[model samples]
Target: MTDSVGFDFARLSPRDRYKLLIGTVVPRPIAWVTTVDPEGRPNAAPYSFFNCLSADPAIVALGIEFRPDGAPKDTGRNIRASGCFTVNIVSDALVEAMNVCAVPFPPEVDELERAGLALVPGVAVASPRIAAAPAALECRLHSFLEIGNSREIVLGEVVHAHLRADAVDDRLHVDPAVLDAVGRMGGHGYARTRDRFDLPTMSLAEFTARTDASDA
Candidate 1:
């Protein structure tokens, strides 16, 4: 195999590099977010720059991008206005519904209704959680980190959580085969979380004993 020369990221435009980076990062987890406007209209959108920032405090974050004219997107605006939102985990069975939320519909348009997703009222916040999702985190805005023109990293504390009956066990180990979670994979590509394996970690003494046993 021949080695290729590296391309300077600084030389390329931000948009170009962003596309390259997002495209190369395979199987990103999708955050199917739900928010409400000042007028009580529901809004939903899918963002991949999302993850669990904290577990004890139950904090999840989303890196929201601004419009081309350096304006906040609908999701950002709604969250800023209401201070509450829901992060719904996307599954293979609900990929189509998740895509429906991605449509650039008018502010008045209810993506949940368009996607035919059921809404379960949240406990700690006014925002409603998606019933189709196996797990939903009802969050309240903790803080916002402004990155650049039109980009903000939103940190939210999960005040309430809803898990599907069949998804979790007494030990809280979620069954992947049952969840069938889907992940983003650059462009229009996506991946299923079905293919999984387990690797158990061993203690130092156990490792040493295993080595000694192998030698014997």
Candidate 2:
């Protein structure tokens, strides 16, 4: 194998570092986060720096970036104020609507309505979920961490999840084909989950047998 070029992140500007990271991360899941302000007005936004961090405690983390003017974004502020939010899983059908929500709308604006997406009330949280989403997780704020002036990490404990009835099975296994999730790629690209392959984990004995077979 040839040696790979490396760039020192410490020397790179924040924008350059972000560009490199996002460009190389392949496809990241989009968290269509929904939150409500103090007056119960709904807000929705899409964050690519979001994922399930823990299964036992059902924790999800969102890396929310502050606005260029050094103020928290509406979604971040709403979550901070209410201590709860809902994360809707973006599917292929909802990608356009999700992008509409990503627009930098003013705090008073309802992105959900602007995007023309239907809303469903959250059971465990005051925030609502996108009715078109394949799945939605009702999360309460577990913790909030200020990483730097640029970003805030919001940790949420999922209290309840609503999955599309036909997408999940009795065993709680979700069918990716049915879900048809869309993931964020670098730049203006998005990826589909339809092109997928499964690889089952192998036991030690199975690994040894495979090795032996290869050697033979």
Candidate 3:
């Protein structure tokens, strides 16, 4: 590699390491997660450090951060209390509401109500799902990885899912264009999923043939 910046993560400050990670990760899928407290009050929050980890059991992971006061955030606390939550896919139209959920509101405040998003009863989980969300995955807490003081990695098994009517076909194939999802970029930035291209996996023979042809 040519001249590239390097860092010793062990020596770097946590904040600096975080900055680099978020900056280089480019666009990350936003998981607009919802969970319910003991009183059944729903809590909503957006976490970019989230993705599907397994397909066989349908597992999704969310990197939930703790508050600066060393206490778990509302969503984290609610998930631990309820053992279930909903992961709502954030579409372009719901970006504003998603941002509203990210606000550090008090635990007593209902983010769904404050954001003016409709919440529907979750079929498989106690947590509610955002009705406006293009797709919502009802997840049961499979496991929790307590890595450090900063964040907790939650691995959830998707028990059920809800998708927009026009976004999916009978064959269960989802149309990305119809979903119109958005991703979180570094520091107050976001990216659209519209501009996309497809590239098929190539066989070794095909790859060799292409390389020979190019050499010729």
Candidate 4:
């Protein structure tokens, strides 16, 4: 005998549905973003619900949420003011600094300075990228998507990219091992890309040939 269990989200509350979503998502990539305020102070934050939205347009997205009183976060405000931002890929080596950048400091405070992170000037934008980040994408705001009361999605077009010289090839193939990227898990947890393997697909003719050779 066996038993099965399922939860009907339609009947459940929104908060419950959110819990299920985040719990089941397991690991999500973190985008360590940097933007400059109107006064030119740098702001940084880590967002897990972020990913590339389009390749042709070279767009990336970050899902941001407002505070309880519906105030926009520093990231959103900075992006609106400057129209540009830099996204640095989080790595295991930079996790501690990345967490420090996540602190909700006052608008006048520069999070990068607070976190003791060094910065390099972005090629296509005024925003600076984390000096130790394995890779950085410089972007300009393309559009904004309002999902609900608290959630706002910002889509940005990639204007420039910088990768550690040894991590990429002449053809721009990035070596996963060199990146050492880390991902966010549910509730103060993270995962590393250290455990990975690649499997190549075989053609039908190759499979048939192998089968014939085995019988012989």
Candidate 5:
């Protein structure tokens, strides 16, 4: 057996814990979130600590960190004020643009425009969707959990989804090859979804048959 190393999270500093977690989590999905302030100024930011949690309610969760000075980030504030936001899937083609959106721009700055990205009006929410995104999820604020003073977990229930016409078939199965989504790795690293494989689950009877044939 290979040797193993472990660190007790309770004894580690937040930064150290973050490094360990992000480093070992492999490629996490990126949520290119878009929201509009009360004044209608659009904001865009990319967060890797995000995922879909519940399909029955179509809930998605985003882990947003508070600013170092202890203020909520623009995206968090905007979502609280507007009660809505849109999550745009970052594709290989949009990786650079997504990075641009991650810049520490002032709240007044329109990151989408700064990144030279286009937006489409949300059908069910006021927040706009990235026009070039392969997929966009329109969501309404379902709940918010304040974790300590440094982080927050935002739960948004997806009300609608928009997919590139070519990416989805009649039965709504998305073609991963067409989507070409990008994911966040540790630090400055990123990963592509192009390399993939499939393994189907075997039933108990099939497993037994396989074992019997192997013994024979």
Candidate 6:
């Protein structure tokens, strides 16, 4: 027997559908994105709807939402205008600063400065990155996707990356404990990535052998 209910997305309101998606998506990666306004003023913002879309081309995607008036947010508008952005990893230590950047500020205000964060110039892009971030990816606009009047998806090809020397190794493996990155949850919630366990994938022979052994 099962106890399950279904809410058809087609019949639900956008707000309700969004609530369901965010609530059920578990923890989502946070993109501490940095961009420059048309006049070259730096801007920093955080988005939970972001992830690495492809590794072959090293591409990342950011799903940016518009304002209540249907105006593009600073990050999306800046990316559309400049064709470049930087994504900084939000570690536990940087969570407060990342949240400060999320506040709605005027176009002239520099969110990075307000958060009192240090910055470093991007190696391959005009946008800068947070100096204290565990990792940062400099990206150029690859494409844009307009799902509706409410959201815009920005696909960017990562041209360069900077990793903390103490966190990443020459073999390119990252120590999760050292990185201590944070993630976003539904509504005003966040989660830490420190708690993790590994379960290796088994081959078919190994699976069959384990199953047979268990049956005995």
- What TM-score would every model get versus the actual structure? 0.90, 0.98, 0.97, 0.89, 0.97, 0.98
Clashing pairs in 3: none
What is the C-alpha local distance difference test score of each model? 0.88, 0.92, 0.93, 0.90, 0.95, 0.94
State residue 208's C-alpha deviation in candidate 1, in Å.
Answer: 5.5
Instruction: Assess candidate 5 and give its lDDT.
Output: 0.95
Off by over 4 Å in 4: 1-4, 201-216
Angstrom error of the Cα, residue 116, model 4: value is: 1.0
Q: Highest lDDT: which candidate?
A: 5
lDDT tens digits, residues 1-216, model 1?
998767699899888888888887777888889888899888889999888878888889999988878878899999999999999899889999888889888777778898998888888998888887988889999999988775799999999888888988999888777778899888788888878888899999999999999999
Off by over 4 Å in 3: none
Candidate with more favorable, higher lDDT: 2 or 3: 3
Which pairs clash inside model 1?
66-150
Q: Write the per-residue lDDT of candidate 3 for residues 112-200, one digit (tens) a residue.
A: 88899999999988999999999999999998999999999999999999999999999999999988999988888899999999999
Colliding pairs, model 5: none
Of candidates 6 and 4, the better by lDDT: 6
Question: lDDT at 35 for candidate 2?
Answer: 93
Stretches of model 6 off by over 4 angstroms after superposition: none
Give candidate 1's root-mean-square deviation (CA, Å): 2.3
Greater-TM-score candidate between 4 and 5? 5
Runs with alpha carbons beyond 4 Å of true place in candidate 5:
none
Regions of candidate 1 where Cα sits further than 4 Å from its true position: 1-5, 205-216
True-structure RMSD for candidate 6:
0.9
